[model samples]
Target: MPGRLLWTLAAVMLAAGLVAVGLGLRGPAGPPQPPAWAATARPVAHHAPVMARSVPVRVDVPSLGVRAPLVRLGLEPDGSVQVPAADRPGEAGWYDGGPTPGERGPAVLLGHVDSAKGAAVFYELGRLRPGHRIEVGRADGRVAVFTVESVERVPKDRFPTRRMYGPIGHAGLRLVTCGGSFDKDRRSYQDNIIVYASQTAVR
Candidate 1:
């Protein structure tokens, strides 16, 4: 709860690992200005209760038609987050070191914008807007439904490490992927697509 402790955790999360960068991705102009999601049905409120710890089994974003099995991601020997392996069945990975999807803290999810052959899990990640729905099915059989609050594209050099991971007052979810122009020289995208959402409901 202390500010210093919060930032310490955030630093660990950032150093844990970044998402799997795609080989070739089509970058959008940039992240759109975030409008409030308050006008939408079931706007984010503090009424929702945080659930107990449980690993997520799958993730579904109906608006984007994204439904994929979830995989566990953790720190590597080098102290970085492990990249989702190509042979893995899941399209995206959950940062197991952090809180679960429905827990009273930020749940981090990572994915690639594209794969070597073609488009991957988060190919249309930039298209998501405020109020879009994100559902994470937990192993405990309960589903945590989150409503998108904002989406942004920032240069990888300036990724919001603390802002994205420090808060823990409520249940939150962060979906991250590569975006912006691909710097062929660097072999990665110039920016990162980050989706910030909060638990609005549960079942």
Candidate 2:
């Protein structure tokens, strides 16, 4: 969202260069850009798991007075969501392949801790502690509640990708957002804070 234009340009440049090369042409053109999604040697599918089309009716965190709508989004080639810009900033979205909230697996929700401008919806997510409650209401009229178990901040360079996105032994929930100090050069947060929770109650 913050650098949408930059990403668009990179994608376009990469696509163009690939097309030219495949046509066996010589290019005295500008530097080639990285592909939008890298062209892997093996086939990879970006398709998300099909789930019942149920709207996120509500999200409630009494400690934060955070009761808001939830949206679903697919991951980018960078493995992160294209966070909504200013108008609908702070909104959270689900990673489709990850588990659903009330089901038996890890459900992931991602939000922007802050945008290029300022604090975003999940700016205070790091403050939550074990035992704090998170409730999600579904369009099907089902409400699921999860209890926080831990909160951790890890550097982006060493982000625990597998632990955060890997298979889980039980029905779990994770809330992720940018944290730690901001990086001026990178124009992004230096760390990512995650909140781990598990299914406690459902209605």
Candidate 3:
């Protein structure tokens, strides 16, 4: 219910052009700072290394019951990350400017918490727990299996740019959606829910 309450209001603003697409990807000024917990958070740990050069086709999070097709998203004219079409809020968008899932960096997957009508793809994203598995199917026929490390609820104004979109020593994943409470006057969610995960397996 909290997710829905925050998601719908943000969705309404996103539909109305009040909220920027992939608002958390880029800050108005500079690069993002890695979250405080980054040092303790282990990268996706596994045996041999695999090069992730393929594009993502879909993302499946069994714990949250999420399986959504992926769309390639680029930056806007002002250099902000682009999001899926507002009309199609259920879709998830992969940031093409960054490494693909299973790659040696933080691959971004963004979705609307809710749509204009109701709950969207990532409505229950905040419910995911550490160690949850997130499977991302790639265009190259491999599934990048990631293990969740942590989840944080941060204010939109203080989104960690470096910790989130920054380069990592190993394959990583970031699942982002609007969270916190909705501000009626602002017509948007005041916080963001970010899931931090690491690539642990490939198949």
Candidate 4:
């Protein structure tokens, strides 16, 4: 119910924006489409070997009240990270581009705020406030707790890469998800709201 509460508010904002956009685009006649080009299959290039490290076993955030299992997955063909299922779904894996959680770098955890079917694990993540706690349990029998320092919503197009992936003085964590108004045509949220937390206590 806590997760749904936040999602409902987001949905309302999306609905209102859609109505306004629909009213504004009343008279629109677009140009005709160009001829389609022949589709050609390109050879897939070999990539460097993935660092087959074990995935974090679980995540616990007492402040926002979350404790759930986590799973690791590779990137999809479209370059977007896969979203874990909402009901009894595993945690969405980290983007290989970033550091692993608990390592001496910035680790990222992404999830769907809410899928088409229902509330996702991170539906209430946007509600987290500064000074909250986020604990990540690793398969190595170690747990990392990060203290929330800040939370901000940034446009997807203008996501602060340096801030998210840049070097931090110490181990850090970032929680990301699609937020802001949902565009029906795009079928995706317009912006990404990220919560930045850093290691405060580890056990």
Candidate 5:
């Protein structure tokens, strides 16, 4: 791809959706980062429904002091995920294509590491440590509580699409944002920071 087109797509990916932000491209950098599954050996639990279906209204990461409203996001025409506008960079968005929080599958959420203004939502996402609690408020008057499992930084070229999007027979949540050093030349980050969490309780 041409440099200009690559730059444009990077902008759209990072500024427009979580797919690109979670999946980083491998450039002249070294070997590709290992997949999240390979990075951890703990088995994901398979459980029956713990809560009813409902749209996520807010995400609260008390450890990061983050409390933001969630906007519903869908895929773009090209089949890529859509992200919130730059103007609303402080807000996070839930991918409508996947399972809703507290549901049976992975619920994906995307947010900008920062906007032109300053720090945006998920700026501290990478700081979230294992065992930290993540609470997602649902429209059905329930809150989906998840416990951080693992955090992985992977290159986009090796994005684990099938694994991240695959059905697991249980409730899961994936929080994604751009990571790695920003390449001024490429106008994008070289890696994606992914926070993996599994539903523990809902009320």
Candidate 6:
């Protein structure tokens, strides 16, 4: 699909807000513009050498002590990307429609921050800062190593779809989960936490 349309769909998904994590809480927050890495990040037009496509089977963040098997996720009836099954809140899901790990595009993953039971896969996502490492183990017996560049916590309404999903020449990964304040009445988070990283190696 054309990058433009693909990102538009992703934007729509973000706009709709992730399918609400856990249940019951109250508050609101959002990330600022011009991510910290903006000065160093290459512009979208400069094509980098991206790796061949491969199915990502696992994800790990050593610094945060996060590791999980990846399940494929597709769009919902309303066009929003589906979240992992609520019962399996500890799992993280990859957006099957976008680029695979190591491929030259944004590889999206979504996980719950917390479930009714307790902390979920990406509960510590907000604590991540630039320079952290994220690894994606692919089906072909290779792992794509990515270096964290920024972590953004933004309101659901101000979702930065362009920066998160827009055209890019190098392989990228986005870790997303509900964040900020929770609305007890709405039973949802008022914001989202997005971790941005770029593929730096294949092992």
Residue 98, model 1: lDDT of: 82
Off by over 4 Å in 6: 1-11, 15-18, 21-49
Q: What is the lDDT of residue 125 in candidate 2?
A: 77
Pitting candidate 3 against candidate 4, the one with the higher TM-score is 3
lDDT of 1 at 146: 93
Better of 2 and 4 by lDDT: 2
- The lDDT for every candidate, in the order shown, is 0.76, 0.57, 0.71, 0.56, 0.72, 0.75
Please report, as a residue range, the 10-residue window in candidate 4 with the lowest summed lDDT: 30-39
Clashing pairs in 3: 32-161, 32-162, 33-161, 33-162, 33-163, 34-162, 34-163
Better of 5 and 6 by lDDT: 6
Error of 6 at 17 (Å): 2.9
Off by over 4 Å in 2: 1-55, 77-80
RMSD of 4: 16.5
lDDT of 3: 0.71
Comparing candidate 5 with candidate 6, which one achieves the higher TM-score?
6
TM-score, prediction 1:
0.85
Q: What does candidate 2 score on TM?
A: 0.68
TM-score of 5: 0.79
Q: Give me the runs in candidate 4 sitting further than 4 Å from their true place.
A: 1-54, 85-90
What candidate 3 gets wrong by more than 4 Å, as runs, is: 1-44
Candidate 5 ranges beyond 4 A from true positions: 1-49
lDDT of 4 by residue, 70-188 (tens): 77644445444444544443354465555667676678776655543455566666677666678888777777777777776656666666566666556778877666656666666
lDDT of 1 at 86: 57
- lDDT tens digits by residue: candidate 5, 84-196: 77778778999897789998878889887766666678776777766778999999888988888787886766565545666666788998887766666566667677788
> What TM-score goes with each of the models?
0.85, 0.68, 0.79, 0.68, 0.79, 0.84
In model 6, pairs of residues that clash are 25-182, 25-184, 26-182, 30-154, 30-155, 31-154
Give one digit per residue, the lDDT tens place, for model 3 in 90-160. Answer: 69989887789988888888887665656677777777767789999999898988898887777777667
Cα RMSD (Å) per model?
3.8, 14.9, 10.5, 16.5, 7.8, 4.3
